[model samples]
Target: MDEYFERRKRMVERLKDELKISEKVAKAMLEVPRHLFVPPHMRREAYNDYPLPIGYGQTISAPHMVAIMCDLLDLKEGERVLEVGTGSGYHAAVVSRIVGEEGLVVTVERIPELAETAKKIYESLCYDNIKVVVGDGSVGYEELAPYDKIYVTASAPKIPVKLLAQLKNGGRMVIPVGDFVQHLYVVDKDEYGRVKKRSWGAVRFVPLIGEEGFED
Candidate 1:
């Protein structure tokens, strides 16, 4: 336990120096025990700054990427967030820490196995503010529409219009768009419901498979 804590501390420090992530994001990342989200065999590498395969061809994003996305969204306490891929649920756990008890994280995953595992992890860690649902994430979880912030962990050929419609006015979404190559984009909806987009930089992510996304 102490070893994992020390590794996590070092990982966060490196992320802060290298990416210049915000204090809030760093704090959230530091508080989440990433090892709990990984497969038992890969727990030793959980804090390393790289993606790791969880299962079903899905991956848990690197810690730096998680920090970058959270910083871009400008997550705040009491704001609800929608995460479009639950993978290992590490990202959601970190976001839950930042959002606090007053806020909520509604994360959607396509695979039931991953969702169940993530749900169990959240319950075990007492991350009660997070809700995991199994569904097609590309269409966005509309049962609770208009979130304060949204993010997609996979790459899409284009910005899924369904997701854009679910962004509350003044909300922000960070997603990666492309086919063979992808770039991270920050999409914001203004108070008047006007949408604007800008690219953050190139990034590679597994393809998002579903309606409004690449066909499986």
Candidate 2:
């Protein structure tokens, strides 16, 4: 337990230095036990800064990526957020805490097994505000439309129109685009339905497979 706390503390410090995120966000990162989100066999490396495979050909994103994406989301208390991939539920859990209970988070995952595992972890962590759905995440969850923020964990060949349509005017979305070399993009939707895009940096992520993504 002491070692876990120490490693978590280091992760917080790294997030502060590397990502330049606020201490409040760092506090949330420190408080959340990432080990609980990974498979038992891989728990030892939970605090490491690298992504780890979590079955289903998916990976729990690196802590730096998580922080960067969350920072990009620019979440506010009581804001409704949508997450494209739940993975191990770590990112969704972080978002859940940042948005608070009054806020809502709907996370979609294509794989049923991963979604089910993430749901169990979210429940165990008492993250009641996060809702997990097993489906094609690239299409976005329209039932909970007008989300204040949207985050896609997987890489897409192009921005999904469905996801852009789901964002509330003035809302922001962080997504990675490309196959071999992915770039993190910030997409903002204006009230007039105009969309603006900006690139943050380079990243590599698993391909997003769905209606708006890869054919196979």
Candidate 3:
């Protein structure tokens, strides 16, 4: 446990320097027990700063990518955040830590099995504010519309129009768009309802599967 803690510290340092993440995001990364979110067989590699398979054909994003997306979302306390993929629940845990008690994190997983696994993890982590639901993430969770921040862990053909509608004015969403090659895109909706987008270079992620995403 001590060694994992040390490795997490070092990983955060590297992420701050390499990914240019803020101090707050770095702290959240260190605080989340990443090992708990990884498979027991792969726990030793939990803090390696690389993506690890979590079964069900899904993989957690590398730490660098996680930090970059979190930075792009610019989450604030008490803000509602919608995560398009729960995976191992690590990213949602990190977001939960940042959101604290007041804020809510609604994470949707397409696989029933993964959603069940994530629900248990959330209970163990005592993330009462986080909700793990089994559904089509590409369509966006409408029950809790108007999210302050939205993040899609998988790559899509294009930003889902449904998701954009879910974002509150002045909110932001981070998603990777493309087929063979993907580019990380940061989209922001302004106070006046105007949207601006910027690319954060190439990235690779599992194709987001659903009506708005690529055919699985």
The prediction achieving the highest lDDT against the true structure is 1
Off by over 4 Å in 1: none
Error of 1 at 173 (Å): 0.6
Off by over 4 Å in 3: none
User: Over the stretch 1-216, how does candidate 1's per-residue lDDT look in tens digits?
Assistant: 599999999999999999899999989988999999999999999999999999899999999999999999899999999999899999999999999999999999999999999999999989999999999999999998889999999999899999999999999999999998899999999999999999999999999999978998
- Candidate 1's displacement at residue 200, Å, is 0.2
lDDT digits (tens) for residues 26-133 of candidate 3: 989999888888889998899998899999899988998888888888899899999998998989988888887999999999999888888898898788989998
Better of 1 and 2 by lDDT: 1
Q: Residue 112 CA error for candidate 3 (Å)?
A: 1.2
Which is superior by TM-score, 1 or 3? 1
Alpha-carbon shift of residue 50 in model 1 (angstroms) = 0.7
Clashing pairs for predicted structure model 3, backbone only: none
Q: Estimate each model's TM-score.
A: 0.98, 0.96, 0.96
Candidate 3: what lDDT?
Answer: 0.91
lDDT of 3 at 197: 96
Top candidate, metric TM-score: 1
* lDDT score, candidate 2, position 23: 65
To one decimal, what is the Cα RMSD in angstroms of model 2 from the true structure?
Answer: 1.1
